[model samples]
Target: MPEQDDAEREFDLKWADNAERKEPSARARMLAARWKENPPEPQPFRADPDPAGPRRSSWISTVIVLGSVAAIILLLGYANFRAPY
Candidate 1:
């Protein structure tokens, strides 16, 4: 404490306090230590060939939804023209 600067002493004290107050899981500790030693590599960037093109699943769902809406509108129109119950 005497040899260390104010900031270093404060950091050591804070580190000790955190270590005492919170105990990390074995897996968490291992991962954190590993990351400190060797960080994971970032993925290489790749530009999309067709960013504006619709995805198959999304396009199909949209078509189904539009068809359902059209059917409902037609049913309501037909009901409106029918005789009162």
Candidate 2:
């Protein structure tokens, strides 16, 4: 029984060795060949600007305008509702 187990282990190792010796897939070989023939080219940095120029009114400007209008309307309402005391 021990000899049989030893033979089976040896057979499994042989099979593993054969599998490891197999060649890579066709796609892998092609990729390797391409890399060897012509390595990748280094790319340069690129910068692109927005097609449209700066906004007419920035967020801060819009916020300020909206706040000023709201305050003016509230002040007018308060003045009109005040009781004469």
| Top-scoring candidate (TM-score) | 1
**lDDT scores for all predictions?**
0.87, 0.83
What's the TM-score of each model vs. the native? 0.35, 0.31
lDDT of 2: 0.83
Per-model RMSD to reference: 11.0, 12.1
Query: How much RMSD separates candidate 2 from the native structure?
Result: 12.1
Query: For residues 1-85, could you state the per-residue lDDT of candidate 1 as single tens digits?
Result: 3599899999999899888467889999999999999997775588555678655788799999999999999999999889587
Q: Residue 37 error for model 2, in Å?
A: 58
In candidate 2, how many Å is residue 82 off? Answer: 0.4
- Encode model 2's per-residue lDDT on 1-85: one tens digit a residue: 4456888899998888888467889999999999899987765566344457776758889899999999999999899889565
